[model samples]
Target: MVGDEGRLVGGRYRLVALIGQGGMGRVWRGVDETLNRQVAVKEVLLPDGLPPGDRAQLVRRTLREAEVAAKLGHPGIITVHDVVRDADVPWIVMEYVSGPSLAGLVAQEGRLPWRRVAAIGAQMADALAHAHAAGVVHRDLKPDNVLVQDRRTIITDFGIARVLDGSAGTRLTRTGAVVGTPQFMPPEQIEGGDAAASGDLWSLGATLYAAVEGNVPFDAPSLMPLFHAILAKPLPPPRHAGELGPLLEELLAKDPGKRPTAAALAVRLTALHHPPTLRDPQPPAPPRQIHQRSTVTAPAQPPNAVHPPTRPAASARRRPSTSAAPGGPSRRTLLLAGATVAIGATGGWWAWKSDTKDDAIRAGTSLPGHTKNVYALAYSPNGKSLASASEDNTVRLWNVTAPDGDAEPAELTGLFWALAFSPDGRTLAGGGADGTIHLWNAADRRLVGTLKGHKEQVSSLAFSPDGKTLASGGLDASLRLWSPADRKLLARLDGHDSNVAAVAFGPDGKTLASGSWDNSVRLWSVAGRKSVARFSHANYVSSVAFGPDGGTLASGCWDNSVNLWSVTGREKTATLDGHTSVVRAVAFSPDGRTLASAAEDETVRLWDPVEQNGIAVLSDHSGALCSLAFSPDGKTLASADKAVRLWDLDRQLPAP
Candidate 1:
C-alpha cells in the first residue's frame, strides 16, 4: 500500500494525499505530527525478491544519503529533513515545495520560448553548481526533479538516488535503473559508469532542450534502441531550439568530456535570457558541401563605393522573417542589376557558393595565460570565469568571455596543488605545498582565511556540496574535514597507509574516497568517520573520483592503468590500459559514458569504461600533462602541461 491516506509514517508524517508515483517510489503530501507542518514524504518500495544483504545495504545507503542531503543549504535545492523506516520501507521527509515540476509546465504549455527556457536553465545550472560545490550530485536530474516556484526553478529529490544504484541488480527497474530518466540520460549513464557532477549537468541540458524543443534529444519507445541511439546516433539538430542548438549539441555529445561545465552553461544560458529572440517558425537550411575549386571573393567596395540593396535567397522566401526582424521584411528599394546578381551568379546560374569550411583547429584559439607550467585549472560556478594555478606561485583568474585577455591574478606565497571554487563563485580554495589551504574572495582577489591541519603538503581539496565543509588530503596519509565557516577542523580521516594523493566525495557527501601511494583507494563514511571499503590498485593511485551515481569509483594509477571499481562490492570491475606513462588524472564524463585519462605520455584518451574499449585519444598537448578536466557540459576538455590545451571535443573528435 503506497501513500495510504490517514496512515502515519514513523508516528510523525501523516499521509494526507498521494501526490506522485513512479516505478520505485511514491510521494505523498503529508503533515508532520510533531512539527505541525506540511511535508512531502517519499516512500521507497523495495522489491520483495531482494536478498537480506542487498536490502540492508540499500537501507543504510538511503539513511546516509538523507543525512547528507539535509545539509545542502541552497535556495534552489530541495531540503530533506529526515529519513524514517516504516513498514519495512524507508520514508524520506522533504520540505513541501509548492509548485508544479518543469515537466508539468512543458506538458501544459507546449514548447517554451528559448528565452524562458534559458532563464530556467541558468537557474537550474546555478543550483547544480551549488549542489556540486557542496559535494552532492543529484544523479537523477530530470524535469520531474525540477520544480518551478514563484517563477524560479528549484531542484528537488536532492540525494535519494542511492536506492536505485543499490537495487540495480534486481528490484529497481522495469528495465535497468539508469540512475535517471532514460530520455534525458547521457550515454555514459546507460553505459554503466557512475554519473558524476557532469552527468547532472548533461541531464539539465537535456531538460532545457526538451523545454524548448518539445521532446527529449533521444526519444525511443524501448530501452535497447534508446540505449543505442544515445550511444551511437548523432544528435539531431533541434528544430525549434535555434540559438540553443549548439549548446544542446555540445551537451548531448556521446563523449562526456566534451560537455560544458555547469558554470559555463549557466553563463551561456544567462546570456540568452536578457532579451528573448524567438527564431522565425521555419526549418533551417541544411549545410551544402562545396568544392574547393569554387571561387569565393569579397564584394567590391572601394574607398567610397556604394552598393545597392540585394534580394533575399530563393529558399528564404518561404519565411520572410529570415531576411528581416519580427517587425516585417525590410522595404528597401533595390537596383535591379545588383539584385539579379545577388541571387544568381556562379556555376552556370546555380546559387553563388563557396568551398566547405573545415571545422578544424585554427591558430590563436589556445589561451596562453600562465608563465610557467600550469598545474591546475577550475571554472567558476557561473562559467564566466576561469582560475589557473601555475608553478610560478600565481593563481590567475581569466574572464573566459574573452579568453584571449587576462584578468587580475592573485599572488600566492607557495605553489598550489589543487584549486576549487565555491558553488556561488564568491570564494576560492587553494591547497598548497606549505601544508595549508587558503581561501580567497573571488570578486576582489583578497585573502580571506587559511586552514591549517595537515602535517605535509596538501595534495587535494574539495568543498562539500553545501559549501559549509572543506575536505583536504595531504602527503601525511590523512584526510581532514574542515568547516570553512567556523575555521575549525571537523574531523580527521586516517586510513591510507601512505601519502594521500587525491580525495573525492560522493554526490550525497556520505562517502569520501581517498587514493594513496600505498596502492589502494579507500571509501570512508563521512558521518561515521570510518573506512567502509578498500579497493586495491596495482600501483600507487594518483586520482580517485565517484561516478555521478555514486555507485562506481574510477582511479588512476602509476602502473599506467585506470581502474573502475564497484563501490558496493569494493571490487575492481575493469582496468583500462593504454597510456604508455603513469596515469596522473582520471575523470568520468558528466554522463558516465566516457572515461577520460591523462598521463605523462603526453596524451589523453577517452574510453568506454564499461566495454573496456578505447574511444578517441586527444594528443593536442605539447608536453607531458599534469592534469585534465572536462567542462560541465562535456563539450570541451582542458589539459594542463606546459600550458592549458582546450580541446573542442565536438570539432576535434571523429564522428561516431
Candidate 2:
C-alpha cells in the first residue's frame, strides 16, 4: 500500500520525494531503513469510485505484473527489490539509479552524435532481448522511460503498463483503447492488437529517431491524422543519421514479421562502436535548450527511404481517396512536404500597369458591432464569411452575403485578440486575452471547443493550408500548434523573447512564419519541429504573411516599415517605407502580384514587392487599422478598425 511522504511503509521503507509520474502511478525516491540505502518506490494509484470487485481485481493485477518484472535480471534492466501493501494499494520497491533520463540528456545536447546514439540503442536493445526471452515485453518504451546512469542505460517501468492484460480476462480499459504516446506507438498498438516483442523495437526506433533528429517521425498535428499516419503514412526518412537510415526503417516496419530480430539489431548496433567506459557521474545537466540544430553533417542527397519489399502495393498510397472534409481541398492537392517547390527564384514581382478598363479597390461594406476597438479579422477559406474579434470580449461571425448583413456574436469571458478560419472554412478559432483559444462552428455559429495552455494573452492564430494544424501565438512569448479537429495540442514552440504578434502558414503547409514583439521574425520547419531561420527587424514585428506561392515572406512592424524576404535564401529582399505610424497587419494578394499592409496611420497601402514601392493607398478609415485579409477570390479586401470595412478591389483600381 502507498504512503505519503515521510510515512513508513512495510515497517521499514520511508517515502521521501516524488521522482516521476506516468500512466501507471508515481515513482518516489525512498529509503530502506533496514539497509540504510536509497531506493525507488512505485505507488500504484487506484482509481476512485470503482466497484469493490473491480478494485480488488486491480490490486491483484498490479502484484502479478510486478512479479513478472521482478523475475528479470539484467544490468540494463532496473532491479526490483520488494513489493508490499499498506492499505490495499501496492507499492513496488526497486534499486535506485541516480542519473538523468536519455530524454533529459537529449534535451540538453540537442542531439547526440550518431555514434553515441548507436551505443545507447545497443544497450537498450540488449536489455529488451533479455526481457523477451523471459516472456516480459516492455510495451511502453520511450525516451523518458530510459535512464542513463554512470554511462550505462537502464530501462524502467517494464511489465507494469498492462496491469490489466485483456488476455488475462481483465477489463480495466475499454476494448481498443490505446495506452501509450502516439508519437512512438506502432500500427499494431494503434489497431488495438496485442503488443508483441517487435512492438518494443518500433518504439525503440522512434526513441532513436528523436535522439538523432530531435523530433518524432510522424508528429501529426492532431488525433485523427496522427492515428491515420500511424496506420497509413510511411515513416519519414531520417535526414541527419548517416548510414543508420536503413536500420531505422527495418526496425519501424509496419508488419511485425518484417522487422529485424532483436539479436540482429544488437549485432548491427554493437558493430558501430564500443560503448563508452564508466566514469564518475556528475550532476545531471539542465535540459538542452530546444530549437538548437545539431552539428551533424546533412546528407548531400535527400535521405533514402527503405520500404519493405513484401508490403502490399495498396499500402503505399500517400493518403486515402476519401472525400475531403467540408471546404478542404482534394486529396491530390495535398502536397508532400519533401517536394521542394522553388520560392521566388526569378519572378521578381512583375509590373502590370492597370488599364483604363481596370478598377481599383473601393470601400463598400461597413459592419459595426463591437463597443470597443476591433483587434482582428479573417475571411473564411470559402470567402463566404468573415470573423472579427475585439477588445469588448466578443467574436462576431458575418455572412458576407446575408440579405440583412448581421450575425450574432459569440461572447467570451475574456477580451478577444485574434481570429482565424480553419482551412476547410467549417470552423473558426479565436484567441483571447485569457490565453485560451475558442473554436466555433462557422456554419451554425455554435461553440465547438476551447483549448487552454498558455499563461498570457493569445495574440494571433493561423491554420495550415491543409487544415490539419492550427498555430497560435501569444503575448506569453510562446507559439503552440493544435489540431483543430479534436483540439489536441501538437507542439509548443518557444524561442521568441517577447510577445508573439502574428503567425502564418507557408503555402505548402510545411513551413510556418511567426513575427514577435522581440523585433524578430522566425521561420519554422513544421515537419522538422524546429526553427530553421530567424530574420531581424528594426522594431516590434506586428504582422507576418506568406505569398500565394510560399516563396516570399512579408512582415509589418512598429517601425512603420514593411519588408519582403526570400524564403529560400532566408534573406531580406526589399522594404516598403511609406507608412508614418505602426504597421499593424500585412496580407498577400491571391495573384501574388501585390502586397497589402495596414497601419495605425489609418491607411492601407498596396505595394509591388519587386519594385519595393507603394502601388496605392486607401485612406477610408478614420481609426487605426488593426487587421486585414483578402478574400479567397482576391477581388475583395477586409480591414478592421473600430468597425470592419470591405473594399471591392475590382471596382477601385487606378486607371493607366
Candidate 3:
C-alpha cells in the first residue's frame, strides 16, 4: 500500500499520489521540496508476515540496486536523484520521466512500427551497454520498464534489477526463489543460471518482439509450461517485425555467446532505423571522424547531473549531488543536480548574436515612438533589433544596428506590459494587460498566435535560452511556461502571493528568476518545472535579472534598493543603494562584469559587480526610467522611460 498523499518521507520526498502499484512495491508521484522538483519515489514493500531476517536482507538488496542504478550515467537511463531509508524501509527517488511505458503505448495503439521499435531498441541497447560497462547487469528487462517520449527512450525500474558486481553476483537467487518475468527471461536464466549481460540482450529482444507484435513471444498459463517454453521451445517468429526480424532472431538466439554485443546491437538497430544513405565510400578522415564522435558522446559519459547547464564542469566530469543542509544556504544546489548534457547542453547568459557597432551606440540617444510610459524593453539576440512595450497600447521594433538614421520602427497595436525576443530573434512575445500573450513573427511582424491562460494581466515574459519554452508571469500570481511552437501550455508554476512582475532565464536555461509584488524573488529550475529557492526582499520585487555567468542573480525592489545574490550560497552579497525612489528594472551586461538598474528617479546606474559598488550613473533621461536592457555585445545599454534611449558603454559610462 502507498502512503498518504501529503506524507513527507525522509524529510525531503513528499508523496503526492500513487502512480504505479506492483506486487513488489509502490511508486508514487512525489516532490523533492528542497529542490522544488518533481520526482518518482518507489517504496519497496516487504511481503506480509515475512521473517525479520528476510526483511533485512531485502532492504540491503534494494539499497544495492539503487546504488548500482546511481552509478549508471546515460541519457537513455532514468537518473536516480536520491535513496532514502525511512522506517527501516528503503525508498528510491528518481527523475520523473513524463512519458508512457512501452507496454502501455503498445497496448493502447496495438503494436508499433518496426522502424520505431528499432530506434527505441538502439537507445535501450546503448543504455544497457553503459550499465554492462559499469559491471552491472539488469536481471529483468521488459517493455514495462521502458518509457517513451518523442524520440527519447528512458529505462526505469532499476530497483527491481540485479547487480552483477563481484561477490554480489553470488546472490542471484536465495533458495531457488525465481526472479525476472517468465516471458522475457533468457533460456539459461530459466534453468536457474546466473543473469549475464547477454541475458539482458535476450530480454531486450523479447521486449522488441512484443512491441511489434502486441503480444509476448513466449507465454504460458502455468509456470512449469512457461519455463519449458523459455528453455526448450523454438523462438516464435514475429509477423510484424519486418526489417527487425533478423536482429530480433539474433537477440533471441538460444546461445548467449552467439547474440550480438550491446554496442554492436545498437549499431545494427540504428542502421535499420535509418538505412545508410549512398555517399562517398571514403567519407571523412579518421581523425576528423574521431573528433566529431567525441563531441557527441561526451555528454552521456557521466550520470545525468541535475545542473547539466553548468558549463565546462558538466563536460569534464559528473559531480555528486551536494544537497543543501536543512535551513542552510542552498548554494551549489543547482550544480549538484546531474546534468543531462555537456557544455552545449545549456549555456550561460546564453549565446547572443550581436552585429551592432559598439561605437555607433551613444548615451542619451533617444528612440522616441511610444505615446505613453514604456514599461519594457529588450534587445534582440543579434543586438540588431530593439523591442519596446508601453502603456500606450503598442509594441514597437527598432533596427538599432542599422547604419543610417532609424528608417522608423515597426509598430504593432496591443496593450502590453512586458516584451521579450526569442533567442533566435525570430519571434517577439509581448505580455498583454488583457491577460494574454501575443507572439509575432519577427520577420514580417505578423500576429502569429496568442497564448491565453492568465486570468489577470500578464506583466512579464521571457524565453528559455534554448527558445523551446516561453515563460510568463502575471497578476494571476502564477508563472506559466508555454511551447511557442505549438501555442500549448506546458506547465503552470504557482507560489507567489500577489502578482509576478519579472521573469528571466539564466544563460544555462536551467534556472529561472522571477520577481513578484509579493516582496519575494524566486529561482526555478526550468527543466524540473518547479521553484528551487526564494530570496526575500524588503519591498515588492519590481524586476529581476541574472548575470551572464549564472553565478549571480539581481532583483530591483520598491524600497529603492537592488540586491545582488550569489547563486553559490543563496547569500545577498551586495546592497546597491543610490536610487532615491522605487527601482523599476535591473539588467546585467552581457559579460556579467557590470550590473544596470533603472529607477523612477530618472536615472540608470551601472555597478561594478566585483566591487559591489555603483560605478556610474546615467541621468540624462527626461523622465523616470522604467526598464533597462543591455545589447548582446555588452557595448550598449537601452533604457525605457517615456520612450526608449540608447547608451554606449563602449564610449564608456559617465565618470563616477
Query: How many residue pairs clash in all the candidates, one count each?
Result: 35, 9, 13
Model 3 TM-score relative to the real fold:
0.46
**Candidate 1 lDDT, tens digit per residue, 560-635?**
6677787886677766555656677888767776678887666777666555555545544546566777667665
User: For model 3, how big is the CA root-mean-square deviation?
Assistant: 24.0
Residue-level lDDT tens digits of model 3 in 464-496: 988999999986568999999999999998888
Scored by lDDT, the top model is: 3
Give candidate 3 misplaced runs (Cα > 4 Å): 1-359, 403-409, 651-656
TM-scores for every candidate against the unseen true structure: 0.45, 0.45, 0.46
Residue by residue across 1-656, what tens digits does model 2's lDDT show?
A: 23478988889889998888876678889999999999998887776566788888888877888888998877788999988987788989999989999899989889877778887888788688668756788878899989998669999988876564443443324444445567888788777678888889999998988898888888767777987887899989898776577788988889988775554465357545332222236455334221111111100111113211112123121211111235542211111221111111111211222233323322335676766557888888887778887756677777776643465555443467788888788888888665789888888777889999866567889989889999999766689999888889999997885668899999999999999867899999898889999988776798999998898999987666777788998787766665656688999888887788987766777766655555455555656678898989887788877777776565333332
- 323: Cα error in model 1, Å: 44
Candidates sorted on TM-score, descending: 3, 2, 1
Q: How many backbone clashes does candidate 3 have?
A: 13
* Better structure of 1 and 2 per lDDT: 2
